[model samples]
Target: MTCKEAQNLVMDYINRNLGEKKLESFLKHIRECKECYEELEIYYMIHFAIQRLDSDEHASYDIKHMLEEDLKEAEKSIRRWKIRRSYRYGMIVIAEALLCLIILTQIQGLNAGSMEETSFYRLFFQEETDR
Candidate 1:
């Protein structure tokens, strides 16, 4: 068989698709032609490597997709945590403001009480001065 014929039959030979007569002819050509033999070897290696790569392709895609989903969930969890922290901070500020308002009101009441006592002193001093 010619090199071209042998090259054409390489796939059939690899897959065991050739009949007995074609198999013998294909082998005979490969043995006689060094270039054809090398070509067959190259094709065989490529076919097997491609098959192996395909087998792992599905698993790799699955792992990649799972990781992406996990990342999204993690981001969502972080967002929720930030929202809760912001709400807590807001509530703390409101509580502190209310506490300050109460303290100011009590101070004002104290000042009003002291003003009444001062007025009594003013009236007694005026009577002394008039005498």
Candidate 2:
């Protein structure tokens, strides 16, 4: 994702409004781009502080920790999604492999059925039976 794109998502990100796919991209871009991360951090702080203003007195005092915790949870959510996606991909690959194997096995079974009734099989296997 571009810095421009990441910057644009900052408000949505802070508001917890980004979809999973968008959130993943935004987080990745911010991690790689310090500028974007700082921009996000500033926006998040201001937004969060504003939100805190309307809350109880004690809640407003822990803005830094609250931001850290929220960001950490967001990061963890992306990590969980990554792991699940990888597992799904791996399962798809396995399913494809199983499908190919089934096709090949069916083809081989058809060929063997035809081959066993041929003169070659009679000469090879019937002779063996006689021996």
Question: Highest lDDT: which candidate?
Answer: 2
Per-residue lDDT tens digits of candidate 2, residues 1-131? 99999999999998899988999888888878989978987887888677667664454456556666877899899889889999999999999997986676566657777655555555667887767
The TM-score measured for candidate 1 stands at 0.41
Candidate 1 residue lDDT tens string, 1-131 = 88888899888866767765676666667667889877877776666667769786543234334433543554455567668989999999999997986676566547777533343444555556646
TM-score of each model, paired residue for residue: 0.41, 0.63
- For candidate 2, which ten residues in a row score worst on lDDT? 55-64
- How close to the true structure is residue 105 of candidate 1, measured as C-alpha lDDT? 54
lDDT of each: 0.66, 0.80
Quote the lDDT for 56 in model 1: 68
Write out the backbone clash pairs for model 2.
none
